[model samples]
Target: MESHDRLCRRLALLAGTAVLAVDYRLAPEHPAPAAVDDVMRALEWVASRPKELGQLLPGTGLAGDSAGGLIAYLAACGLAGTPALPDVLFLAYPNADLSLSLQSVSEKGEGWGLSVQDLAFYIAQWVPDASLLGKFSPVEVARAQPLPVRTLLATAGHDPLRDEGKLLAEELARGGTDVEYRPHPDLVHGFLTLDAVSPAARHAGDSLLAAYGSLLSHTAMLRRDRNAPPDAPNGAT
Candidate 1:
């Protein structure tokens, strides 16, 4: 929670945007839908009480790193066609695919801190029922029902989950969702949380903040243009 708060504070400052850090339930005990449910509820609350949430404008986006990223994506998927759908998604090294189909899971899984075995253990704890894996996995969700929001996906080149994030970005783009894929060539998994210790991680963090800010500003501009009277002059205030 401390690390998340620190990162959120940095993002809010860098992007000049309000950040709402959710403290969802953990896995192994809460498991599967518990965390997802909490995050979905949080999204709903953000949509319902925009004034309380710093008067968040339309096109408010969702963001997370690793497991939290998966939750954010899933929540966005579930909220599709609803008033609570997020305008954008920013994922950092997200575990989008749980099938372990990507080669990076084996090649860079070990020796980089997060091993394939560690991933398996976490998956087991989160989704003990193997059959339910596809239902909870974001990649599968994207395959079944393409994401309906713009996305900024950041993948760490040295991370075990790198390929899956890349694959998801490709799938989203192919499915017609606007996506900006950024790859950090020298970072590893969990780097977003290690910015305090690693210069490379800090640089990655800055890049993500910049992308997020730009996306928000662009989306807000589009919204304003669409809402303006059809006959209004270009660049009209």
Candidate 2:
């Protein structure tokens, strides 16, 4: 929780928006299902206090990195039918599939900081039974009614999770959800968070923040249009 709070404080300075970095439990020691359950609980917690969250920051959105990215997707799905949809979802090199069939895992070699073996180890610790992949995998989840909230999903060219991220974006778009997907060819997994060292990482982080700002502007415009009095002489008359 302290980590999330500290990161949110840092990101708030750049995004010009109040950021809420959720600290869901980790896997292996906790198992995949438990990790997902933790995220669901956090989602429910936030939804329950919408007024408080709104007062803290008018725009309430969710953002995550790596495994947390996966949780963000699940969190969105958890709120699928609820009235408390997050205004935005920002993902960085998200792992959206448990199938682990993404080509980059093998074809791209070790250029990405993450390796296929590392992923396999993580999966083994989280999901030992391959047969139950569907239950735990985000991609395997059936398309929910109303689709997901507006999403901004980003991937790294050298990351194994790249194809999965694109696949997720396509799936969401097919389901009639709003999506904006971008991939940075020169980067690798966990880039944005590694900005303290890598220039490419910093660039990717800046771009993601810019995308969020654009979404906020559009949201503001929509709010203004909706709240404009009908009797007024502007476009609504």
Candidate 3:
């Protein structure tokens, strides 16, 4: 998460909340399910005692970008149908389809920062056993179930994952989840990590993260005082 420190810090500032950054295992080193397991454990730890993180917090949320977004989605699915499920979800440019069956992967994969070949390598490394791809895929895992919570799903216009991310949002919404799908036409993949360098990326990324942070702030606020004024707007950046 070193590369994304800027985003985390900015989100904390904008939303007026503490951000717990979990250092989950990386792929090609620890492999599939390790990262997911780490996130699940972290969530369970938080849910087991929410008061420690924030006093009188109204809710909790799970957020991720790019590959982490994929893990967040999968983790949310695993935590579904329980009290541990998050109150909100924030996914940014997540490659929802691990099978690489989405159309944009072939049409707009190359020339962008993340190519199809590169994606294929990472995907294979994450799940060495091809047969288990479906089990780990958000598209496959979340098709029938609800999105687990209210979702703020964003897609990059020039990214190969654009289609699949959009598909995931649409399917989750169709399955009866409140979804706020934001297609960032001006941004690229990993915009959240590019905030410190690129103005447009910062604008787009901060706004999204800020939106999630706003929820956190709102939750904490309401929990502190049920009559704590009306809710603020969503995008705070």
Candidate with best lDDT: 1
* Whole-model Cα lDDT of every candidate shown, in order: 0.87, 0.73, 0.84
- Model 2, residue 24: distance off in Å is 1.7
Candidate ranking (TM-score, best to worst): 1, 3, 2
- Candidate 1 vs candidate 3: the TM-score winner is 1
- lDDT of model number 2: 0.73
| Local distance difference test, candidate 1 | 0.87
| Model 2 Cα lDDT, one tens digit per residue, 1-237 | 654454466567777776555565666677767766776676677767767665543445778878788877777777767655567778778887778887877766465578787887887778878888766666666344345578888888888888888888888888877889898888888777677798878877877877776786577567678877677656753
Number of colliding residue pairs in model 2: 0
Model 3, span 56-99: residue lDDT tens: 35678888888989999988888888777888888999978988
lDDT ranking of the models: 1, 3, 2
C-alpha RMSD by candidate, in order: 2.8, 3.5, 6.6
lDDT of 1 at 125: 93
Q: Looking at candidate 2, what is the lDDT of residue 16? A: 76
